[model samples]
Target: MKRILIINPFGIGDVLFTTPVIRALKENLPDSFICYWTNERVRYLLEHNPQIDKIFGLSRGDIKKICSKSRLRGFGALCGLLRNLRKEGFDIAIDFSLDHRYGLISRLIGIKKRIGFDYKNRGRFLTDKIRIDGYADRHVVEYNLDLLGLLNLTPPASRNLELIVSDEEKEKARELLFKAGIYERDLKIGIAPGAGASWGRDAVLKHWPPKNFAYLADKLIEEFNSKIVILGDAIEKSIAEEINGAMAHKAIDLTGATDLRELAAIISCLDILVANDGGPLHMAVALGIKTVSIFGPVDPVVYGPYPVSPKHIVLKKDLSCRPCYKKFKTPVCLRDKECIKSITISDVFDAVRRLL
Candidate 1:
């Protein structure tokens, strides 16, 4: 294929999962142009990526409209997006987003080869569908790379994910920290309290609560003498504020302040990152930074840190319905997210201590 378009207009972590496939495509099909389409907020995730030739940002507003109750607005926006994709004359279209809209749009745009997961038989919309039962007990990186099977090509040995942060970005990240009075001597702990599935959908769903994070931050400050920084987009500033407000020791709140690349660079400077099972956790793992992740509703097997390095530690409660996040957009848990509630501050404290 001369022109390949990967549609992954979703969360930052999901976009990161496709990095290996991008590298494989660039190495195996060296001459082809690979275009990455993702949420506008996450375009920075791919801009410096050497494997991807072009990074296209999809509007968050349009995506919300497409997923919202307003059918007329959603359909109109989808049609416009469909026309735009058709105009690109893509030789191959891959829908890593797994949302039916992108798969349907690929089909409607007349792409000969469209690939995606066939969850709940959405295979009707995708030309080449790979089916997997409930959440596959494997890392999401391997799951995303499975799409490459459509070309009858085997994956390369080195599946190391890539994120290119320029030296300039590194300098800026240091500057931001320096200005915050966080010297090089201080141990930095980054806390990303927001997840797209959690905050955008339901705060109580896939998230480990704000109070827990607040308590954890205080414990780190008191015990480890670590400087904490809360990371998230503007939409999550309120959540960040809640955590910061509840904390005894003040944390540098960079929520709604840094862009995606900036966030990546900042994360690179962290001694260890502590976060919920979401984007920032994946970002830290990819950057090769030590991370302590709190898992509740989501299964650690599916979304946990890949390559299972000692640097990445996941703390999850043992429960029969631990992965209830998979059952519905909002979990159907009767005990009010007891899975997350059960994971005490001491549990996370122990995990962070091990990494520190």
Candidate 2:
């Protein structure tokens, strides 16, 4: 049986974008062994996927943490990881990292066929590559599926995002919701007021004002009697609290309360998710839940909900400088992110109402 390794050391949204590729690989090559290489934080997202036979997790933070103590030990750790991969005897490697490091590692490990995108000539070690300036004009999933042409494979008709949530996780999520005073009859609407950690300190640029979220939540409660539940990492607890503080109605704050798997489970229980462009937005799409996502610098066409439908509503400005985030970079904004800030609560509320 042929062994294949897929390399993608990105955040949740970027990593999730590659799911269609994984599904296509397993369907076309049922007997082949498929392994994934990702960061430790998102390992939970892939652990339950039956299409993936094994997973290797090593983050840059892991090496940096070791190096801070001893450079020699850090070197040894990297070498040890390489040794494990070399022993795997992988015949093919599909690299989605857009970096030369993974391609070089695949070659050093004796992989014959290395395929990836040649972004800005970074795929020098790749045996086969598609040259591109950046993710524009088409969705990222389509770009990922295009890589399959080198292997003489065609994408499946169904290109939905795949996320496998276990039965136990679903039960745990339901229990948590029950404890939060949410029941089966409640019209549950989840809101993520903070942008995800992918943007780090600059995440604020992607955020629609917290006051807007507060107003929208209150409006939803008044109109639909919706139970507002806040979702985010622990670091974003303050932002969630700010939204709750501004709103006359109260919301259950679950920031940093659940792990990644539980987060997915909680999202699955929601009737609708209103969030900024980030991981949770994509998670809701994968779970087949409706989403009304806000996009600012990033182009929704390139990174928005896959298989766009009426079920998913995207809110974005049509300014010329709106989609400044292109080619994997976001230029400094002179307008102070008016692209996202200009979006009013009424706009989002109307979109959510239409979806509901």
lDDT of 2: 0.91
**Highest lDDT scorer:** 2
Best by TM-score: 2
Task: Please report, in order, the local distance difference test score of every candidate based on alpha carbons.
Answer: 0.81, 0.91
Clashes of 1: 0
Backbone clashes, candidate 2: 0
Q: lDDT by residue for model 2 over 81-172, one digit each (tens)? A: 99999999999999999999889999999999999999989999999999999989899999999999999998975899988888998998
For each candidate in turn, give its C-alpha RMSD to the true structure in angstroms: 2.9, 1.2
Report backbone clashes per prediction.
Answer: 0, 0
Residue 261 in candidate 2, Cα distance off native in Å:
0.6
Candidate 1: the clashing residue pairs are none
Stretches of candidate 1 above 4 Å error? Answer: 59-84, 197-201, 327-330
Give RMSD (Å) of candidate 2 vs. truth.
Answer: 1.2
